[model samples]
Target: MHERLSFFVKRDSALHHLNPLTKIVLALSIILVSIFSPWYWTSHGLLLVVIVPLVFIGKVANEYFTSALRLILPAAGFIFFMQAFFQPIGQTVIFNFWFLDITQESLLFAFRIATRITVMISAFTLFLLTTHPSELMSDLTRRGLPPQFAYVIISTLQILPQMQAKAQTIIAAQRSRGLDTESTFFKRIGSVVPLVSPLVFGSLVEVEERAIAIEARGFTSKKAKTSLYEISDRSSDKFIRWGLVILVIISIVLKLWLS
Candidate 1:
């Protein structure tokens, strides 16, 4: 399970073959477009058209949808309640209750916001599920991010598994001590706090040790750093990067012309 979580899905799909940098840039572009474009269904529909196919191609549709739903549902609920209560009164009210009014415009706006968030969430989830965390760190470092920043990103990824293992160990040790995790909500919460306190302290110490180790290994003084794995830049990568740049330019031009 640890091995599965750490590695990328080894598929022979075109997206899997693209350089991680290209994928990151594309994902960011889509996210930016989704956020800045008009909060309308058309803009969100276009984003979905692009992302849904990719999710299917990557064979992570279920995971992507699950992650997206977890974010979208709460967001949708909040938008619904807020708009239903706080939206400005308009000439065309859809519903009137005692002292509240829900206008058609507000309903549309709420729908637009919820759809936009869904598109953004789905776009990011697809990107994260497809790209390996290590590859993302390497790409960032190659793109001139400080080695320290890359180390921080990589360390964060490494820490998740370590923390999980440590938590399991602590839970077992506590169980041996007759601590009950299946007690009332407050009791379970209280019991786990002390059990996990050492893990939190240990993580801080580990981080300090890592920082010292990195500095001692000449990470800061080195003029150049090399990666163990190199992401090959092929003709296809160049073509795709250029294509995306052209697409962004076209989108901007269209937006201006239409406006």
Candidate 2:
């Protein structure tokens, strides 16, 4: 779960050379475009033509493929399947599973939904893969994003993996003491309390210490903050950001017109 959340793959590539903010704009633009596209197949086409190519351009194709297989596919697949069975718009029935019927209209709708979801996730996955968390925060801070927001974002990213590790440790300890996570559904439901309680309380215990640590480091200092690592924005990065802004505008216009 955390692996999917913090899926940064460091590589020296064209995508990595772009400013963090540029990548963010690009990601947001793609997400908006996919969601508001006039054509049914627009999102699917973007996923295949834009996102797949971006994985190679970023030189993190291997990691992107891994994430798509492990995380993206499963999530999008479930939603697609659910919508196909339950959506109420279809006239032509494709199949029937007891009370649930899959219809042609529902299948098309689900296809669009799944494709949009893929485009959204793939765009952000590429952005995170190329840009470091600190670099992203520093760039945003330079552009008037609150310093506290930066601290919060970076701190959350840093702590998530540790929290995941702690959860795994607790699960392992419980499993050793005869907790069966793979048993029946009711058993798994019953097991949630034991698994979550420890992780929740343990994380809570660290909150005070984390607050103190941030305060000691002058987290709220009014002086202009400095970045240890410099990320230079080139003319090309500016051009790309402007292009993405235009694309976002176009997407919104199309959405309104369609509605």
Candidate 3:
């Protein structure tokens, strides 16, 4: 499962036991507050004081931080640097890079955006790590989310690894035939046909078979479906969800007032 795109980890903690809907609400609320709140410190506070602490509270700190370092930090850093260098000219220049300048105002703006992104992705990362995809899908299905949507979501997550493996196989085969990734741009361009045709069409061809298989399982049946595993929700889950919802509403109100 480690090689799969789904990031769920097996953990025995209060967070892991929370109903999938509760966790989704929690993650969404944190993301909304960090992005839309009026206070300058709110995003940073949520990241440092809320999401980071929840990592340990959920007992998945190691996996969460691994995802942060491997995926979130690089993306946030790229956005930060791009904003810092390319933003409109301002008075106080802190650093210069040839034709580009980093000013205090742009630095502050970039930092704010980066912190918001960090909070948003971290919230999702924690939720994904603690909650299984099947549980999330099942709960959403129970809540009247379309069954097709659930199938698409779970299948999309699982398909990534298969696509990647197919790409690697194509690359290896091309390499054996003298295709070079490190070669000139034109050569790489030449290799793309060999590399991508099979990868793309291979996936496309399998879709029909997968659809047939799903239909065979009565995917579109009107009868009520049963879950193989039972998910439990408790009073605490309800309390946390309500509290988060109220907090999100307050944040939106504050943003409106400030504007």
> Which numbered prediction scores highest in lDDT against the true structure?
3
TM-score of 1: 0.78
Over 4 Å off, model 2: 1-5, 168-198
Residue lDDT tens for model 3, 1-259: 3255777889899889899999999999999998789988899999889998889999998898888899999999999999999998688999998989999999999999998988889999999899998889998898899999988888888888878888988899889988887779998888888899999999999989998998999998988888887789899889999999999999999999989
> What would you estimate as the lDDT of candidate 1?
0.74
lDDT of 2 at 71: 86
What lDDT does the true structure give each of the candidates?
Answer: 0.74, 0.87, 0.90
For residues 1-259, write the lDDT of model 1, one tens digit per residue.
Answer: 2532353555666777678888877887676666555436555675568888888888776766776677767876787678766778466887888777889887877777666666766666677777887787787778887878877777667778878888888889888998888879988988968688989988888877888887898977868777799877698887887787776666666666767
Greater TM-score among 1 and 3 belongs to: 3
TM-scores for all candidates: the values are 0.78, 0.85, 0.91
- Name the weakest run of 10 consecutive residues (lDDT summed) in model 2: 1-10
lDDT of 2 by residue, 147-174 (tens): 8898778777777888889999999999
Better of 1 and 3 by lDDT: 3
User: What TM-score does prediction 3 earn?
Assistant: 0.91
TM-score order of candidates, top first: 3, 2, 1
